[model samples]
Every structure is written in C-alpha cells, then in structure tokens.
Target: MEHKILGVIGGMGPKATSVFFDKVVEKTEAHKDQDHIDMVILNHATIPDRTSVILEKNEKMFITAIKKDIELLEAAKVDHIAIPCNTSHYFYEDLQKMTDIDIIHMVDETVKKIVETYGANCKVGIMATSGTISSGIYDKSATKFNIDLSVPNQTLQDQIMKIIYNDIKNDLTADTNEIEAIIHDFIFKQNCSCVILACTEFSCIKLSEEIQSYCIDAMDVLVERSIELSGKQLKSLQQNKSNAAII
Candidate 1:
C-alpha cells in the first residue's frame, strides 16, 4: 500500500503544535519507527497571532504567512495537511483557494464528532480564543449538525484567553482548577452536554478526570482525521492495551 505523506501547518502557539504531533504518534498503530506515517511539520512560530488579526482587522500578514507555509508544504509533496489551531481556521476557505492540497477542517470534524457521540441538537460549549468564537467557524458546523452552541460570558472568555496566551503559550503552568470550574459552569449552569476545547492551546493542559469525560479536544479530532486521510489506521483498542503493557 502507498502511504500518504501528512503535512502539519503548526506552531500557532508552538506548544500546542508539539502536543498535537505527540497525540498523532501515540494514536498511530506503529510497532517500529518505519511503521509510523511520513510527516512534514512546518513549525512556523513566526506566524502572527490569529486572534489579533481578526479583532484588529489586520489580516494581510496572517494570510501571507499561512499561504507561504502552504506553499512550502506543497513543495514538500505532502498529500494532505492539518492545522492544529482553531482560530486560524477563520481563513480556512481562503487558504484552500491558495493550494490544491487538502487541509482538513478541524472545527467541522469536532462538530461532527459531537453530533455522532452526543446526538443532534445536543447543547455544546465552545472554549476557544476570542477570534475563534467571534468568527463563528464552529458555529457554522454546529448549525449544519443541528447542534446548539454556547460560549462563556465575556468575563469567563477573558479568563480562557489568559490561559491560552499567558499560561500555555508562555510555558507557564495551567491552572487546572480554573479550567474545571469553567467546565462545571458550562455543564451545570449552561446545560451543555459536552464542551469542545476549540483552541489548540488547550491541548497543552491536562484536564481533570471528571471534565475529561465530558470534554472533546478539537486537536485530537484533527489528528485522527490526519491519520485516516493519510491512509493509516489508528491504533486498535486491543493494540493500545498491549502497548501499554510493554511500557
């Protein structure tokens, strides 16, 4: 079988990109280094802040940076690509026009997973950067899936922003208690069945067990789709168990 080369357009915040790549490795069905999928990772840490570009209406630099990354990936001959950052997906359509290579839609895949796991019309909470929430990228997919979407109030949203930018991005320790409280409010007060960690930065933090059961990481969805589209199978349930034993 011809294995497809997967391209990762990453380093929106840097750490999140590393986490996403780690997840892909952990989830792939590989016994040897050669069994792993071929990957090209462009850790373009120079890409400007996506949230700022949207809010300030200064998108030229952002678009140019992303387009350059895509061009580099295309030159590398990657079969498909995935971007870990959700906020950057605001320009997803435009990016697609710049390249023929398939860029997997992280938001769409997360929304589809929510509907598949929770059912249509289920209430879902979004925790992301201000730009992602404002752009309504996930909202569009939610509408398509008939899923009701809710977001943190402005005050809480600010807290989330701080966690992503100040904490995770800066390599500081994330406050798990704060994240847990936010999830609790979404579930109990807002009546959401599940919360989507719509920001790639969230992948850097470890969620509490209780919250883990009710939360979905958008980055994980992207990783799974990246593997599938690249013609690789995710590690089977039984294989995962056996691998754990070998550790």
Candidate 2:
C-alpha cells in the first residue's frame, strides 16, 4: 500500500511544534521503525508571530513566510499538511489556495470532536491567543457545529497571553495556579462543559487533575487527524491488533 507523506508546518512556537511531532510518533501503531508514517517537518521558527500580524493588520510578512513554507512542503511532495498553531488558521483558506496539498483544519477537527463527544448543546471554553480569539476561527467552527463557545474576558485574556508568550514561549515555568483558576471559572462561572486549549503554547502547561478532566488539547486532535490522513492506524487501535490488521 502506498502511504501519503504528512507535512507539518510548525514552529509557530518551537516547543509546541516539538510536542505535536512527539505525539504523532507516540500515537502511531508501529511495531518497528518502518511501521511509522512518513513525515516531513518544516520547523520554520523564524516566521513572524501570528498574533502580532493579525492585531497590527499587517499580514504581508506572515503571509509571505507561510507561503514559502508551503512551497517547500509542496516541493517535498507531501500529500497533506497540518499547521499546529491555532492562531495561524486565520489564514488557512488563503494558504490552501497557494498549494495543491491538503491542509487539515485543526479548529474544525477540534470542534467536531467536541460535538461528537458532548453533543450540540455542549458549551466549550476557549483558551487561545488573542489573535485566534479575535480572528473568530473557533467562533466560526462553534457556530457551524451549533455549539456554544465561551472566552475569557479582557483581563483574563491578558493573563492568558502572558502565560503563552512570557512564560511558555520564553521557556519559563507556566503559572498553573492562574490557569486552574481560569478553568474553574470557565466550568463553574461560565457553565462550560469543557475547555479547548486552542493555543499551542497551552499544550506546554501541565494540566492539574481537575482541569485535565474537562480540558481538550487541540494539538492532540490535529495529531490524530494527521495520523489518520497519513494512512496509519492510531496506537490505541493496536489493542485489537488482529482486527486492525484485518481492516
């Protein structure tokens, strides 16, 4: 069987990109080294910050950088691409137009999972970069899925931004206490059924047991979809190895 090459357009923040790639490797149902899916990762760390571009309304540099990455992946002959950064999906449509390669929609996939797991009435709280929230990418997906979405207020949003940029992005320890309090507010105050870690940087934070119960990491969803699209079985499916083989 011919397998598709999975392309990762990453390094929006270097650590998040690393985590996504690690999940891909860890979640593949591979018995040997060769059983793993074929992948090409373009860790283009030099790409300008998505939040800065979106907020400033000057997207030329960002667009140019992303287009170059896509071109590099296209030249590599990757069949599909996945971008791990939630904020960057604001340009997903435009990016798709620049290449023939298929790009997986992370926000759409994440929203679908919410609907599938909790039904249309589910209220999901979003933890993402200000750019992602302002871009309304998740909002659009929530509307499409007919699910209610909640976001932090301006004050809380600023704190979240600091955790993402000042802490996680800069290799400092994340403030788990603050994150937990936010999650608590989302669940108890906002009446959210679950929270989506829409920012890749949030993936770097260790979720406390209470928060872990209700939080969904968007990066994990993207990793799963990437594996599926690449023609590889999920590691979880290996529990039924014989059945998986038959399929």
Candidate 3:
C-alpha cells in the first residue's frame, strides 16, 4: 500500500498536541520505524485561544492565522490535515474551503463514531469547553447522525472550562476524581449512553478504568482516523485503548 503523509495543525495547547502525536505513534501497528506513517506537524501554539475567540466573537483573527497554516500544509503537499483542537473545529468549514487537501473533521467523525458504536439513538453527553458547546459544532454533527446530544449545565460547564484552562493548560494536575463524578452524573442522572471527551486538553489526562467504557475520547477517534486515512494499519483495539488508560 502507498502510505500518505499526515499533516497536523497542532499547538492549540502544547501538551495535548504532544499527547496526540504520541497516541498516533503508539496506536499505529508498526514493528519498525519504517512502518510508521510519515508526518508533518505545525505546532501553531501561538494561535489565539479558540474558546476566547469564539466567546469574544473575534472570528476573523483566528481565521486569518489558521488560513496561513492551511496554506503551509498545502505547500508541504500533505494528503490530509488534522487539527487536534476541538474548539478550533468551529471554523471547520471555512478552513476546509481554504485548501484542496481534506482537513479531518474531528467533530463530525466523532459523532459518526458514536452512531457506529452505540447506535444512532444513543443519548450522548459532551464534555467540552464553553466555546465548543456554544458554537454548537458537536450538536450540529450529532443532529446529522441522528444521535441525541446533551451537555453539562452551566456550573459543570464552568468546572470543565477551569479544568481545561486553570488546571491542565497551566501544567497543574487535573482532578480526575472530580471529573469522574461529573461523568457519572451524565450516565446515571442525565441518562447519557456514552460521554464524548471532546476537548484535546482532556486527551492529555489519562481516564480512569471505570469511566473508560462509558467515554470515548474524541482525540482518540481522530488519531484512529488519521492512521487509517494515511493508509496505515491500526493496532488491535485492546492495545489502542491503552493509550488513554488510567489517570
């Protein structure tokens, strides 16, 4: 098979980008270095915080900067582009328009994965930043897949944001016990079939064994698709799931 190069538009949060890259390498079924997919990663960490831009309604600044990244990836002649940040996907359509190369739609693919795994009627819960929830990107994708979507209430949403920014982004340890409590509420109270960890920052935190069955990391979904799209084989499911194992 002719393998293709994967282009990563990263550094939305430096740690999460590193985690995504590490997951890709860990989850690819490769025995030697030569079997791995070739990659081009542009760590555009200086790009404006996605949540802030969306909340402040300053789309132009983010768009202007990301457009350049797209052009650079195109010039690099990559077969596909993957943006690991969930909130940045709020500009998915516009960014897709800027280049001929396909930019993997993390939100859309995540919704599709839910439908495929749990069935279309499964009630889904999203744990993402306020901007992602407000932008309605996951909601729109869920609607298309006929999957019902739910989100944390305001108080919990604020907690999620703080965990992403104040904790993980600041290089502090995430309170996984608190995070798991929220996940339990989604499952037992809100009746969510499975929760989608839609933020890349969450990808950097290892999930507990109890909630792993009830959650799907959107970043993991993106990593899997990126490998497949690059024409590389996926590691066995049991092995691939280890990358997101116990916090």
Q: Write the per-residue lDDT of candidate 1 for residues 1-247, one digit (tens) a residue.
A: 4789999998887888898888888889888998888999999998999999999999887998888888899999999999999999899999999999988999999999998899999999989999999988988889988999997789999999998888878875799999889989999989999999999888888877689888989988998998888887899868765775687
Native RMSD of candidate 1 (Å)? 1.7
133 Cα displacement, candidate 1 (Å): 0.7
Worst 10 residues of 3 by lDDT: 238-247
Candidate 3 has an lDDT of 0.91
Question: What is candidate 3's lDDT per residue for 130-238, written digit by digit as tens?
Answer: 9999999998998899999997889999999899899999985799998888899999999999999999888887767889889989999999999999999999988
- What is the Cα-based lDDT of residue 212 in candidate 1? 80
Q: Which of the predicted structures, 2 or 3, would earn the higher TM-score when compared with the native?
A: 3
In model 2, state the lDDT of residue 179.
88
For all candidates in order, the CA lDDT equals 0.89, 0.89, 0.91
Regions of candidate 2 where Cα sits further than 4 Å from its true position: 237-247
Poorly placed runs, candidate 3 (over 4 Å): 241-247
Residue-pair clashes per candidate = 0, 0, 0
Once fitted onto the true fold, the runs of candidate 1 whose alpha carbons sit more than 4 angstroms away are 237-247
Clash count for candidate 1 is 0
User: Please, what is the TM-score per model?
Assistant: 0.95, 0.93, 0.96
